[model samples]
Target: MTPYDAPLPQAPAAPALIDGFGRQVTYLRVSVTDRCDLRCVYCMAEHMTFLPKREVLTLEELDRIASAFVTLGVRKLRITGGEPLVRKGVMGLFENLSRHLRSGALDELTLTTNGTRLAEFAADLARLGVRRVNVSLDTLKPDLFRQLTRGGDLAKVIAGIDAAQGAGLSVKINAVALKDDNAAELPDLIAWAHGRGLEATLIEAMPLGEIEYDRTDQFLSLKAVRSHLESFWTLTETDHRTGGPARYVRVEETGGRLGFITPLTHNFCEACNRVRLTCTGTLHSCLGRDDASDLRAVIRAGADDAALKNAIRRAVDAKPKGHDFQIARAAAPAVSRHMSTTGG
Candidate 1:
């Protein structure tokens, strides 16, 4: 395997979290909360049920789980949300996680945010060992953005992006490509991000939540979008990694690169190196399937760190070789879970 795709060595005395396919799981995506301020039309219902505060994992619990994962060979931790910054005492959580990061236990710590509250936490996050961020923005037009997010302010997101950049954070923008919706504006969004020295990625609309929208109608192909942009700009491959599935490219004449996450067109599960931990403590082995292990149950049962590590090891061993999304819809049902909870 290439160095970029090589299987890393396990820590001394630490169990290697390897799947059936022999892929070593070194990256972990942790959703801090299912609470969000915006109701994205494609993510979930506008008025949805949120977990009770008591149901969510406490800061100490989260820290313990993270430590266990780190001991079991998880090298990178990505903090996700339903807007992770919205959770109470989140900055303290960052400070807590940063301890492991600073002392060399965790190789890297990053975040994927909605950018609504980033303006308030950008500086704190940078100071606390967060070095990179990915902000989700679907459209650059004010009215279109508002309509897409059901009342989010585009100006605020823009200010938040600026704030993230000002804090010396390497920022990237993610735009969900919706057929006949924001499909026409993909290049424009990339241009805007490029002008600001930030790369932008177009992600296909995954069939997840029951949002009163047809996935076939909203799904846009990243391959087609890349071909559309090739008509003008000469694209070249780049080695920069985001620790996810996006294929990054350098666009000539543009100050920044462009990215495409073609999960449908090109599935990367063969080289998949990550698993997700939900805020409520379910460890999802695969995002496109419902294979999960309830970590919260074990913790609440008074399990020690060794037990927690064994639980994570079991989850890794159960990780699916690849998602069956390519199978016919009749044979494989849509991934019913929303991106918010899955930490997509």
Candidate 2:
């Protein structure tokens, strides 16, 4: 057949409906497992109960649910976990999801890992069409890293970063700035990532788990962090990209990008356009809030595709305009579960 006689490809379908908050609900964060290798003080304690493997979503179930969400309006998918790479058959799951993108049913697919297991799977993950990765690394110091992660090996995580970079995937380093801990290492972390040609992001410490520290004392706002860096480097705002939380800016002398996720100081709830699915099949509308809908029970009850879709739509509709932690604390505030179980 001649080139002119080729048939036109079909266009991908749009989402079913937009919510009242003006969010298209196009992005989905799927938590594959709640089990993680490290025990960060903010995320979880050294000893904690993990979800039973049986309770977590199966690969088939996750694929089916993700496919349904794509049909509804989820064009982007991010596979997260306590540490997704720790879960088995993750490569197979990525392989299955890749088909949807090829068929124009899914637009973009990404993953968030702790980088402990990324060194082993980086090449395979890239080969499977996962071009984006977010690695959680709080401190560049080996001693501090060990102290923060309880018993994690900082060397392994560094190797993982190198492997990911070698795989030719766009990697973003996620750092949770906690006062009195690794907050002082922010400039060093940014400089290190910039030296290696990778984007570095610093996030404010969020109060979620049953921790003892006061939020006022622990929370290091992005504005303050930026101001601290201004003495060492000048920053200029860069274009905001789609499907992620970070507000980008370029370092003047270094010629590298740095990102800040100021969730606590400046809430981005008004422009929130995402939903989270816990490893146990619960749909969390807001990360800071405990409002969730149990999708596992409904799915197990033989809810059809339409029923599941409507349930997700309802959950999205119920998304709070903004989190009330500040206002709630002024009244009778309550804390939610740890960030590890909540998925960072």
Candidate 3:
């Protein structure tokens, strides 16, 4: 283990993080690395150039940044990545962050992964105070799953899900709705997830980065998808919130909860109370907009806790009201950076 494996010193307390739009920033999604085993068509290209190892933040730095947010009244933390599990010694990060949960400073600590390595780490995650996990699985069909993830093994992801549940961690399925790909299979997939007593969330494709495939052709609106599902089943609106962008609904037929993340058709920015921190220590106040602040420089320069807290507050204060996402026949992505880089 690295020197960062040990618990960090307590950060000095700061005022609550409230954005310019009067939204209290309570949730923080930190990307530990921008590397993933799968090459999802919507997320990134098949052959991608990853960041150099030297440019990424150290595990200890990640702990310090996260602790700074906690000191500023952030209650929920979500570890993300191109795939967070792929980062070596990441469990140590989680273990260190669990101290907040034990001290009642953090209400929840979780991660979003592609589930390729979940089977190997689920037990440890549950022990590290991770009560829930979000697994990105586009399809249940083995061949289609392999196609969507570009050589991802469906069986392995399924095994990971089983292991996560076996380890007593609540599992949620996050499937990106694609027009020509898994759109038709969404209902069946929701049913399958419900049958296993797991929540399923469908997300509309966001035009984040340039890919070989046309996003317009791949874009599937959640509005239309919901209309189709309502024809088959009764979806009653529910007042359930997980401190994320998803809007929840209770499926009467399946007796389970389903969520929709519609960045294109609908905007959840008015109630946006979260920010994303990339692996390189760039803090993005708004996911749709590219306004960012560099916290890595502050910490790496040997700046004290007060400087780090000020840097975080500046980012939060500059948060935009909402994102401008649009999809057309021949238009560039709203944001040039990949969703992986932004901690999807």
Q: For residues 223-254, could you state the per-residue lDDT of candidate 1 as single tens digits?
A: 88889889988899998876688888998868
Model 3 stretches with alpha carbons more than 4 Å out: 1-13
**Candidate 3, lDDT over the whole model:** 0.93
Q: Which ten residues in a row have the lowest lDDT in candidate 1?
A: 324-333
Candidate 2 displacement at residue 203 in angstroms = 0.2
lDDT (10s digit) by residue, model 2, range 46-66: 787888878988988888788
lDDT (Cα) of model 1: 0.84
Give the 10-residue window scoring lowest on summed lDDT in candidate 2.
326-335
Estimate every model's Cα lDDT from 0 to 1.
Answer: 0.84, 0.81, 0.93
Higher-lDDT candidate of 2 and 3:
3
Winner on lDDT between 1 and 3 is 3
TM, every model: 0.93, 0.92, 0.96
Give residue 208's lDDT in candidate 3 (0 to 100). 92
Better of 1 and 2 by lDDT: 1
Q: Give me the candidate number with maximum TM-score.
A: 3
